[model samples]
Target chain A: MIKHDLVIVGGGPAGMAAAVAAYDSGVKDVVIIDRDASLGGILQQCIHNGFGLHKLGEELTGPEYASVYEKKVRERNITIYNDMMVTCLTADKIVTAQGSSGILKIQAKAVILAMGCRERSRGALNICGTRPAGIYSAGTAQKLMNCEGYSVGKKVVILGSGDIGLIMARRMTLEGAKVEAVCEIMPYSGGLTRNIVQCLEDYNIPLYLSHTVAEIHGQKRLEGVTIAQVDENRRIIENTKRFIACDTLLLSVGLIPENELTKEAGIPIDNITNGAIVDENRQTLVPGIFACGNVLQVHDLVDYVSDEAELAGNGAAQYILNGGCKGDSVCTEAGNGVRYVLPQRVNTGTGKDVSLFLRVTKPYGKVRFTVKSSENVLAKAVRIKAAPGEMEKITIKADLLNNITEPITVELEEV
Target chain B: MIKNITCIICPKGCSLTAEINEGIVCVNGNTCERGKQYATDECLNPTRTVTSMVRVSNKCNCMVSVKTVKPIPKGKIFETMELIRGAEVCAPVSIGDVILEDVFGTQVIATKNIDR
Candidate 1:
């Protein structure tokens, strides 16, 4: 078995960032294992710009953003194993992976899980349809068009207004395909506001809000799809049905975090985030194991992924250097309009400020985010607008953590 | 005349009012300098960065992603796309390689390296 001080799984933005940060923090024996032949992961297939505006201070394409870290990993002499799929992970930090060369086993003192997430497939939707060609997940269509040069279809109808779906509307249009409509069951789009402007509005593609695809038509190849507006309870209204003729139906429904490794390692998982339960340091319940990026929670942007992975990477390095963080633990709750909050538990003795990342339950105007312990407000921020489509972050000061007498709760309130 | 514009420079999606009486133009409701510029420019001339995939003959299994080196006039989106449509390139194209030059007054360059 090959031994290393730190082993990072999946070399996407999260894994690459973690490896770089861990190496710079005095842990030199770090190795990254990825299932793709390249280190960029999904970013390799994402060709459009809009990443790195926050972290890198410049707008870059997905591949361009990933290249910045890839250069750092290479310059630091960190080892990387590509085209390798991790098959098993143990409680003791043992990783068994299969690659072109066969089974490879690695025993490590610390492991960082950054496997990211997968797209929700048609099986989850269960829409009435004849199994036909030309159906695709938004990301799959993106990969097919961006990475593997192929036009998915001539006439397209997207069944979700998520970022990928919106982006694909513009992409298909630019590739000379006719994008008829983008339907979303939610009243508000799941995509960022800019995507709605640049991807859908700029092209004049109609976005039907509170609507969804009710039925799909076609046998050998997709011929058309029926769309309908949903009621407040999410059931489709029969009178609102409309048929849109198209050769393709692309679904951009949702994403599920890839946490099979965390599960196999016996780490407790959060049903909400569908990721490993982690603390401020991104350390999982398993002493020497950690989770970051999409494996911790699905983020709307890649810039946040790099930032979160840096924490996990530094946490792993500290674990190797100073054993582990053991102290009084306090639980965090998502209250009011909040959906879920990260750092499920915080260490009171860590002597570091904890950043709480979360999403709101729904869209709101003029709001205040409050982080409080029963009696006192720990932190608060006012915003003009807040929505479930965007993740919001706030930092709880360490001094406030030191004086906290009760479990903290992060809540949103309308101002 | 006055027009309302939503700055797409960032996710803020600031709603800006563009006032142009005569040739002098001014914008309001922008949170940032970039948003202000975007609002004014959008009122004057709208533009967008065009990205799409081009077929590769040799690498029949994969397509090469390309984009205009700079933002093109919004009106020219379809015109530029017409130039991109039915176009094919050979495999072994590297990022930054010019796929189509002077495409609707702008160059279309490969954003990724594809090897068959």
Candidate 2:
């Protein structure tokens, strides 16, 4: 058994950032375990720039930003086990991982969970189609093109208008492939507004809203696909059916936070985020175990992932040094148009101010975000517009929090 | 003079309009302050990310792709690429390693490692 001051699971943004932060924060012994042969995780395949805007304040590609942190980690002499899959995690912070080197057990003073996320595949969608060679996840297609240097197809039809799909549409075009059309089942696009402009509009790719692929036609490889507009009930409208000739199909349905290890550890999971329930400190219910990045919640930007991971890493270090945060605990709730709150529970008396991260339940214009205790508003911010595609954050002062004896609730109400 | 600018600072690509009146650049239509700067400075000089494939000298014969540690002026992209082509790296080389301390006085690194 290898014992260390801290053991971090997953070598993606969250894990890498956490390890770097912890190491920099005075934790000499830190180890990171990842199943992939290398670091960067999903970012490795995301070759397009637009990743490091907030974190690095520059337009960097996914691999570029990840490399920034990766360099810091390597320089710090952080031990990393690649090609290692963690199968089990314990409340006491013991982890069992299987790698090319065989089974490895790590006992640490603290642990950070940053396993990131996985793509939602066809099996999750119940799309009636035979498993064909030409069908690929948008992310998988991206990896093949950007990393493996293989063009997925010449003519392609993409299912779903998520960021991954939209980006892939542009990527395929850059590689000299024609994206026939991008179809989305939802009336509202799930991707950010800028993505629609830069990745789709600039390329003149048609977007079909409230539409879905009705049937996939092919025997050996994908020959074509039949698409149709859907009613609010989501049933394909027979009159709207159209056949699109294509050699490949890519699905960018959604992403699920990889939480099997969290579940195995008996930590509670959030149905909405599909990540472990964590506080501002990124500590889960299990003591000495913290979570961050996509493993905590799906973030739209890699910069935010690094920012959140820093908190988790510092929090874990604090726990090791002080034996954990102890004080009156207060609960946080999302009300009105708000979707959820991070740091679901707070150590009421901790002197540090709290930064609450949240998302709106729906799109709103001229809205005010209110963080209120039972009687008084702790903090508020007015925004000209807000959308579910963007995650919002607000800070509450510790001085104001000290006056609250009850749980705080955050809400987004339109003016 | 009026200048049209595209803010590539964040994923929110806010288009902006800039006018140089009385030697003071006034910008409008930006979503944030960064966009304002992006517009005002962009009119004087444009900047871009430098990304290209470089031959790995010590690792596998395959080419290892690279990018500037920081974005340089748009006009300097080809110059930066020229400097990178002459660079070589040794293995047990990890991804993100600084292959060149300062190419044209700007740090550049390998984003991925080529295994030997």
Candidate 3:
């Protein structure tokens, strides 16, 4: 058995960033284990641009953004175990991994979970359809085309207006494939407005809001799809059904954080985010186990993932050097038009500002967000618009957390 | 005429209104100077950085992602894509390696590294 101060699972953007931050914060003995042969993770397959505008102050492709972090990890001379799958993690912080050689066991002082997320597939949607060959997840198709050089399909109909679906619509169009339409079950798009404009509108591909693929048609291969409008409750309207002939169907409904290891270790999970519940430092309920990036909450941008990973890294370093974080944490609640707030808890005694990240239950125009602790209002900020597709962040100063005895609640109010 | 434009410069996605009269553009509702510039350029001539993959011969990883070094005219996106579709490169491609030169006055460079 090998011993290390810190072990990060999944050498994606989060793991690489966490390793770098932990090393900088006085934890020099760090190791990263990734199942993939390379360290970039999903970013390697994500070849498009529109990444790193906030964190790096420049527009970059996904691969470029990942290389920045990969370079950092390499320069620090950190140990990286590539093509190794971590099969088990214990409550006592023992990580068991399997590689080409054999099973390897490591006793780690602290562990950071950064497994990222996976795309929701057709099986989860319950769309009535025969199993066909032309169906592919948007991410899968992206990897196939971007990395493997395979032309997925010629005529495509995309379901779900999530960023991946929107991106694929444009990608298919650019590859000389004819994109029929993009349908979303929700009235408002879950994708960023930039994507809506650049990917769909720019290509003249129509986006059907409050619509979905009612039934997928074809047996041996996808022949077409039945599209229909959905009402407020997302039930298909009978008379609004229409058929569009296409050879391919791409599903980009949602993303769920990949946390089998986190759950296996008995860490508490958040139903709304589908990730592990963590504190402001990104530390999970399990001591010495930290969760960040998509494993904590699915973020719309990679820059935010890097930011959250740094917090987890710093928290892990403190946990190792200072012994452990001991204090009563104030619980955070989501209220009134808010879906959920991350870092479900915050340690007020840390004497540092805490940033609360959240999403609105629905889209709103001209509103204000209020962060309160019982009777005391902690912070307030107004926005011209708020959408479920974008994540909102509010930072509460350290001075305001003094002697707070109540659970903090975040709510949205009309401005 | 007044046009509503969604500023894509950042994720804030500030909604901007541009009024174009006799070649002079005035933009409103933008929170920054960059948004104003974006609105003006959008009103006059719009461009986009075209990113796509090109086939790589003689490698297991058969594709490498590439992009124009600068934004090209939005109208030329399809034409540029057609040009990229027929282009091919060999292995040992590094990031920033020129794949297509003088594509609408901008070079198309590899954005990823592919080993031989």
Show where candidate 2 strays beyond 4 Å: B1-8, B13-27, B33-63, B66-116
Q: After superposition, how far is residue A291 of candidate 2 from its true place, in Å?
A: 0.3
List DockQ, one per candidate, in order: 0.62, 0.20, 0.77
Question: Cα lDDT for residue A329, model 1?
Answer: 84
Which 10-residue span in candidate 3 chain B carries the lowest summed lDDT?
B57-66
Q: Give the per-residue lDDT digits (tens) of candidate 3, residues A1-415.
A: 9899999999999999999999999999999999998899899988879899999999999888888999899999799999899999998999999996489899999999999999999989999978889999999999998889889999999999999999999998999899999999999999999899889988899999999999988989999999999999999999999999999999999999999999999999999999988889899999999988887799999999999999999999999999666987899999999999998999887788999999999999999999999989999989999999999999999999978989999999988
TM-score of every candidate: 0.96, 0.86, 0.99
Using TM-score as the measure, the top candidate is: 3
Error of 1 at B77 (Å): 2.0
| List of chain B TM-scores, one per candidate | 0.91, 0.81, 0.96
Give one digit per residue, the lDDT tens place, for model 3 in B2-115: 999998888888999999999999999999998999999999999899999899988775888999999899999999998888899998999999999899989999988888
Better of 1 and 3 by DockQ: 3
Segments of candidate 3 deviating more than 4 angstroms: none
Q: Per-residue lDDT for A332-403 in model 2, tens only?
A: 898999888887887776788989989888767779999999978999998767777778889999888775
Put the candidates in lDDT order, highest first: 3, 1, 2
* Residue pairs in clash, model 2: A279-A343, A280-A343
